[model samples]
Target: MQGYSAASLKPIFDTHIKNDAQVLADGWCGYNPLKEECPNLKQTLSNKGKNFKMLHIQIRDFKNWLRGVHSYCNKEYLQKYIDEYFFRFNRRNHRKINFR
Candidate 1:
């Protein structure tokens, strides 16, 4: 949600996330705004609240993957490219690519 405004998340969540799907995220303040924007959303932040619903999916995994592909990539592009990379990784024998 770095580059994305609260308004843009609707299409992304509706189209991509679907229902009954769990969302794992970090402690970024941007997600706070998303609470109102996404009604179905179950966001998790590392910094606030209790009984963390959001899985603290390691940024290192994604960052290393993105960094391996190309440096200077920020969170805006990171989500897209990481999804693409994970797709390829899942398809390629589950061996996966080393981003580092």
Candidate 2:
């Protein structure tokens, strides 16, 4: 959502998403406009403890592993690290080296 525009979000709402897609996301203010824009939109508060427990378990685990490191240091490389981590998570331990 950082660089996305309202125009960009319209397509997602308009697309033939399966089963009235349940989008799980943090409470970003940009989505405020979506309530008026998308007729079927459902909003969930991500800060709720129970919801965070289920949704962010893996990301919390990753942060826990870096507990000893300074927060600012991790912030510097956060995007790259999260991308690589998610790639491995999706791969399920497969170690192929080909770049797609």
Q: Compared with the true structure, what per-residue lDDT tens digits does model 2 show for residues 1-100? A: 3466656665676675443556555566666676664445565676556666855788686776456443544577878777766776678656565454
Candidate 1 worst ten-residue window by lDDT = 49-58
For model 2, name the residue pairs that clash. none
Worst 10 residues of 2 by lDDT: 65-74
What lDDT score is found at residue 92 in candidate 2? Answer: 68
Clashing pairs in 1: none
User: Alpha-carbon error at 42 in model 1, in Å?
Assistant: 2.6
Query: Per-residue lDDT tens digits of candidate 1, residues 1-100?
Result: 4466655565686688756655665556655676554555555545543445322244456667677778777767767887887787567664544442
Scored by CA lDDT, what does every candidate get?
0.61, 0.62
> TM-scores for all candidates?
0.42, 0.51
